[model samples]
Target chain A: MKSEDLETVRMVVHARSGVAVDISKEYAIESRLAPLARRDSFADVGELVQAIRARRDEGLMWSVTEALIQGETCFFRDREPFALFRDDMLPALAARADRPVRVWSAACSTGQEPYSLAMIVDEVAPRFPGLKVELFASDLSERRLEKAQSGLYTQFEVQRGLPIRLLVRHFEKVEEVWRLSQSLRQMVRFRRINLLADLRALGQYDVIFCRNVISSLDPALRGRVLEQMAQALAPGGWLVLGQDERPMGLTEALESISGWDGAFGRNPAFRAAA
Target chain B: MKTCLVVDDSRVIRKVARRILEELGFEVAEAADGMEAMAWCRTAMPEAILLDWNMPLMDGLEFLRQLRKEPDGDQPIVVFCTVENDLEHIALALESGADEYIMKPFDGDILSVKLMEAGVLA
Candidate 1:
């Protein structure tokens, strides 16, 4: 937790993942890395940092970064965004549908957001029969992606935001735990991709949910990430951010729509004028 | 407090549904099967019923059919809770007088939404 070690950890983390760690969060680094150091046969966090500095192991560095990254999430974490998606966004997209709708849940830690989206799409599928929907979810951590792929959740995990109706409908009880139905599981394709890296390979999306991610990055990285997300959208596609996050001065391609809480549409006028 | 009857053959599901319904502010009663559920209905009608599709003695559709003819039976909003996913069975349940349908392995949010949509919970 020394200043120099903190700086090194920060440099390595930001260099690889673009996540900014404040000096005040040195305690968090110590706490998260202490056990990792112990498991790796090191005496303490300092030793872990020393090893990383000495060897510069890419896998070990990634482990440190992933451990430092917080994956706090829940199914339908907030009601408002989902309500907006159900009431406004889906219908608008339905109207403009010429092909299957592609949705990406960026930074989709443990897969709740995209799975929640799949449930909504399933519930509304009867209304728009034959409207094929393809879902893709991505995260920076391979560990979290593995958990997401398993589709298993503990009792306490399911208790958060997941309603009993959905729990019973889309999930099967696995002994003491719950597992998402295979049908729901297959709806999402999970991948490990850092938001700071080239996202064009993921292809354009009709709707993107990049919530609670940009706010954690440094301001400069935040602007770059926002522009990348905007560029990933289809011509008039939607990009949803964490409820309190915004697009002000980050990108000209996106315009915050009036009366929409956390939703932004691609700026057709700006594209037209250009 | 509003009361709801949870009718399912499985005690585990009854307990799970009971916990969620109580959390949503509804007083809950349980019946192991359709016959027992109908008996409970005869004594005191619940405001809503989370009925299972398959059960001993009488199934959910049978209970729905018989309950609609009984006095005060039409009062309880019925939602079919089951693992059956076939569209044909769902249509049959709707035709037999189900207010709503929710698949098995549900949690609090899905239940709350379905109940809210069914006008069972405010």
Candidate 2:
């Protein structure tokens, strides 16, 4: 509400998540933080701001950061990318059969993207025989990861961007919501990860979905983050961003894959043999 | 606009489905049971049929079997929207020529997405 509180919220969110909060959308920022404010027994955004400014509670700060940066997502949020993963990427990986294929859904808010990947793998991987596809999903929010790991979704949640056929196949009706089958749930490993940190500990991925993530990063950090992602990708690996986004010639390590929209191929020169 | 026949015994369910389909720009028709659906089809075939299981006189499976035997019966897309959630039930529906299946207690969005998936709606 006040100028000082506005700048404080902006600084905290940006420093932690690398997401730039628009001061112009003051109502949006307040709306996003309202629930968190209530949870901490604060009346409104102003009080929540004062709490953050005064306290060194790491947990509260993380919660506030996630509240601001998290996004609304659904299963198979976009049709074409899942189609690409199912038809083209899986076939290519299945052909190899030599090494395990690791796919990461980074900034995987509430786990839809990775779970969607698991649904495809569950259906199609059987045809290939012995194709080991390991799926890793991560978000900066511990809260989101918990929900993702639980494999539960409301009727509304399950309905969005999901065909009824797959819903019936992989999820069992639970009261008013649907619980994803244990098989699909177990297929993915969920973790809380900050992209601004060193990602090498998560290991290199053959196919990484950093979709809708880098576009939100502070412009100052975009190039550095892209280079870090480049190093974390295996040679000839794939990196999928949001359909509307690209590297925009930010770094040479990643190049747009011809014919593939919003997908980049890792250049071998980016990282030596490991 | 394309035509869709809602085949269900429940008036409330039919009404609910009708409201949703109408909003999606489909010319909606109603059938109380499979026999009525059959009669309607014999007179004028709809582009799509939202079928349900467990009806008076003729059930959904029997109707599907009989419908396929009719001339130009394969033309209309059939989607089973029922309380049947079992794999065997789904498999049987598919075997009996259901293009898609939706479980009971679904909402407008679920119905909408399923219809789109069946190519009955854009």
Candidate 3:
């Protein structure tokens, strides 16, 4: 692929979605777009790039962008985060008594993280009797959101990180696939959301999981997203970022909690009451 | 250390169970059949037994019956771990002196809860 076509692809993806694709990853673009080109009956990658450059193919552009952003995720992908949330976070939140706890699983790929949160909340909520826990999951892709909303997973998907006990208790086997129990499905509300967009409409959350997403964006966009996440969290709320990402150069509204790499507590000085 | 005897024909199942049970602070043992499990118990009975429903040499039901006749056999917490989920099968296991029953493909959290309920772990 020529430099011009690569630039065109990058511009369209960035303009439509906040995803930053590196020009060095021209091969990645080619591999991802080749199938789209074939399906759309384009002559070649250059032709597809030209079609995207033409500016009228909003549908094609969106499809290409969405394809690039859909990430591979699994239930309880990292055991440490879920363990910290259950053993430490939930119990601490239960003591507050100010309101029922609200959790947000940002960039939830296919509903696993949110469902995992739901299962933990289900176990802990009974202890707090009156506490009304709300689990909200969001992603940038509508296609992924549709799959997430269904709460169905393949055998391989469940096998990734899901414990067999949780599988047997919370999910029912539907032929070869596993369907999340209705009660668990109802625990989460899925929505189409871009981190670069306004998050006020999603409301403030007591715990926000914005993991493994910022590393994909450029440094500037990463900062902006972190700032927005800080704003979206309630006063004294927690923000959990990906292990590799941090708010050091991005935002100062969140202060890292001791002993956990990805966990942050909202700085009361910067947080306005929600 | 509290000891647990895992009886199953499959080495994979035994390994998985051993990993989970060990994490919960149990000294784990393995037996491929009921007869082998009985022989181990005669030497020194485990604090808990994770019994598999089906196996060669002797099945779980016969093993449980023979186990109950031994001194201090009734003291061990016996949990039947298998793929059998029917009411008839569960009833048969319970009647044969199984203290608890759980399906295969189990996870550590559920295993912990089951063990807690069985008074095998504090």
Candidate 4:
């Protein structure tokens, strides 16, 4: 990634995800753009960057981001997190809520995280009796959001992380592709959210899953992003990260806790302070 | 009649698989997702299964994992039909107990050859 192209990615990602990406991760940026460059038959990243700047199509911006963003997601990814949410998190949240429980899947690429959350909610919904559960899934990439909204996957996508029984019950066979049932599709609301924007307007969430997305960010920007995310989380609510990422040294507001592979809790003092 | 279960979420692939299997003289049953496939397998016991990898609810990998745990687990000659062309993915499929693995955009002839190799057809 050239300095100019890196700047463009940084600006776009910052605008969309609120995570400031450093130009230093040139290899990462270059690897992501290789496919786009090849697809467009551009000679190099420089040519691709030039073309991107010349074209003001909003769709192109999203495509660039989609190409760059790590959409390394599969159905029921990292079984431990979803398992923890189903077995421990939702029940606890349900007990505390007087009204419906709201879970936010921040940076929900292509809808895997939120859909996983919905499946868990659906399983426990019958037992909750009066408690209503709503899953709000958001991504920076409109293209990804569109795919999430479609709730359709190729045979390859369905195989990666999903279990068999759940596949049969929740999806319908259209031909060779698996499409999520109307019920499951309806459970999640896919929105294009710029995480760096005003998350205060998004309201409080019982559980915020911002996983596998922070690696793109610089430390300072990551800290700010986490602080904003913390503000959006309800007191005692949990925040889950990708297995490979950590909150340590990023923010003091979230304390690492023993649950869901690895999770962080809103500091009681920080909640009071906020 | 010999039965085969074509498990995938894509309508196009399922149609293609169904047409190919039907032409080969095997009874074809279809399931959209892993859960549905499991339910069908419980009562139907198809002789062969062509399973997709990525799906909603339960995915192909999880389906394979659960299928392997069943009492008559190794009954079907399971083939993984997916777009994940990575060698790691192929190894993972084989490790998960798939009897055969084929990449997507395949021709009917390849499907027939795989079926014959699995002893599902003469």
Candidate 5:
């Protein structure tokens, strides 16, 4: 692809979704977008870029931007966070006078993270007695949101980071694919959302899982998103970042909860309570 | 290195599994079927057993049942890696003394992680 094309695509992706594309990884970027070009009947990436530069097709802009956005997610991508959700977060939220605990999976990619959260809630719901947990998942890509709502996963996806025991329990074999049971699918509602937009209208959540998301944002947007996410959390609600991530001095509203990896909260009492 | 018995009817699966298990630092052994696995276990018990379901001359579940009767059979961590994917199948394997369950089409990472979960590897 031409340098101008590369720059244009990178800028569009970064501007739209806050995902910064590394110029050095041009080969990876081309490989990911090549299929999109072919699917759209473009002979090659250069022609695709030519079309994109003309800005004739408005849909292609979103397609390329969505394609360029990274969507690497699987069931329970990291194990420790889910364990904390099961043992600590669920109990704390259930203890609150709030009837239905609200959880948001921001930039949730293909829905594995939120579905995993729902599975945990379903497993422990009997103990809570009339427990109601509302799960909301969102991503920038509409295609990915559709797949997430489908509740289908490949054999490899079901096994990756997911305990196989839960695989048979929560998912049913559908020919070559595995579909997460309908009840679990109903537990999550997916939406096409941009993190850069106003989020207050979505209301507050008891737990917000924004793992591996804001870290990918351009430096300017990180602080803005961090503060907005902080405001969106219910009082004493936890914000779980990526496993290896910290707030990095972006915002003072979040403080790390000791022993809970990648988990932060407005209230310091989360540690004492957990 | 700790010893692990790799039992499967498929030569290709056994070969692939042996490679991955060896890569995870296990001294690997192979058995074509349950009776053969049983015969091998009587002489020298391995620290771990990767059993496959639906093998000839006795299947994994029966082998596990028979193995539990042996003096130190319960010592080896039994993990069934097979294509038999159902809640009942997994539950039965656990009820029959298996330590772990991995569905077929596995990779090195899957084997390494499952073995670690079984407490057979650090």
Candidate 6:
């Protein structure tokens, strides 16, 4: 792909999905789309881009967008954050409010985050007895969201991060692949959400994990996206960011906690503004 | 028989490690998360712990930090078994008092070798 064409696709992806693609990673982008390009009988990504610009093929455009978005997710992507959520966050949230615990995995990209959250809640649910916990998972890509809803993972995806017991308990192995049980699959409600857009309609959440998805936006867009996130977070609710991502300038309502990467709201006033 | 505590939130991982440890002749105990692991530590007093980095309640790092504060800080050989494959993350785990670091999707042989090196297995 030419540098100009790569730049154009990057801009379009960012504008539509809020996913930032580095200019240096043009080859990766081209390789990802090469199959689609060939399927459409285009010689290369350059021709594909030309075809997309003609606005004659909506299907090709969707395919290109899907190709650009990295939906590479595995169960329990990072172990520590989930650990924190299970040990520190969940109990804290349970104690702070008498209502049902609500969690939103924003940009949940293929459902790993929410499904992982559900597994944690499932493990602890017996202890809580009557406490209700609802998990909501959303992504900008409808294609990804549909895959998330299916709760099916290939052997490779199943192998990473998932423990053997969970594989046996929550999933059934069909040949080499694994499919999540209905019980676990039903725990999360998957939806299509544009994080850069208004999120107030989604309602409040006790914990929001918008990890790794926001770093691609411009700083102003990042701030606006976070503000929309802040609107959905309940007071004392936790926001988990990517390892290198910072929420410092994102929202004033959140105060950085000692150990976790991002901040927590000590006061519940932030969501009240929603 | 020697005893080892496998402290991880993932049941699949715990089971795999337990099988490997048990095959190597160590009796294995398990905890679903760090808090449960801490509770087990108070009573079980296992000779070693195979910890996972990310968990729901208290993560392995926080658990290690808290465990090190106890009076019996040096009681167990704490080895972090996790998917945080970055070298810097491994260094951080060691700096946090983890006796050894094992990355995830690990081979059973590698696990056994690490256990032997840590003296949890012969």
> What i-RMS does every model get?
7.3, 2.9, 7.4, 11.9, 1.8, 11.8
Q: Give the per-residue lDDT of model 4 (tens digit) for A1-274.
A: 5677789877766555555555798998887878878887999877877777888556656666677666778766766788788878888877887877878998888887788788888888898887788889998777788999999987666655554445656876677777899999999988888776767899988888888877766566787778888888887888888888887788777788864567788776654234
TM-score of 4: 0.65
Model 2: residue A246 alpha-carbon error in angstroms: 1.8
lDDT, each prediction:
0.85, 0.85, 0.83, 0.79, 0.86, 0.78
Task: Label model 2 with its docking quality class.
Answer: acceptable
Candidate 2 lDDT at A230 equals: 80
DockQ, every prediction: 0.07, 0.36, 0.08, 0.04, 0.47, 0.04
Model 4 has an lDDT value of 0.79
Candidate of highest TM-score? 5
DockQ, candidate no. 3: 0.08
lDDT for A213 (candidate 6): 74
TM-score of each: 0.71, 0.84, 0.72, 0.65, 0.90, 0.68
What does candidate 3's lDDT look like per residue over B4-113, in tens digits?
A: 99999999999999999999999999999999999999999999999998899999999999999999988889988897754467678877888677766777865776
TM-score of candidate 1 relative to the true fold = 0.71
- Give the TM-score (0 to 1) of chain B in model 4: 0.96
Looking at model 4 chain A, report the run of 10 residues with the lowest lDDT sum: A159-168
Tens-place lDDT digits, model 5, residues A43-142: 9887888897786476887898888877998777767788899999888777874578899999999889999999898889998986688999999999
lDDT of 1 at A139: 96
**C-alpha displacement of B36 in model 1, angstroms?**
22
lDDT of 4 by residue, B1-122 (tens): 88899999999899999999998888999999999999998886888999999999999999999998986768988988888755467778888888777768776766765665456777
Tens digits of lDDT, candidate 6, A1-274: 7777887787677767676777698778889989988998988889988877777466676677778887766677656688888888887776765888998998888888899889999988777677688899988788889989998887556556665445556877565456899999998998888887777778888899888876766666776777777677776688887767776777665666887755455335444352
Encode model 1's per-residue lDDT on B13-51: one tens digit a residue: 999999999999999999999899999999999999999
Candidate 1 residue spans exceeding 4 A from truth: A269-274, B1-122
Q: How many clashes does each candidate structure show, in the order listed?
A: 16, 0, 1, 37, 0, 20
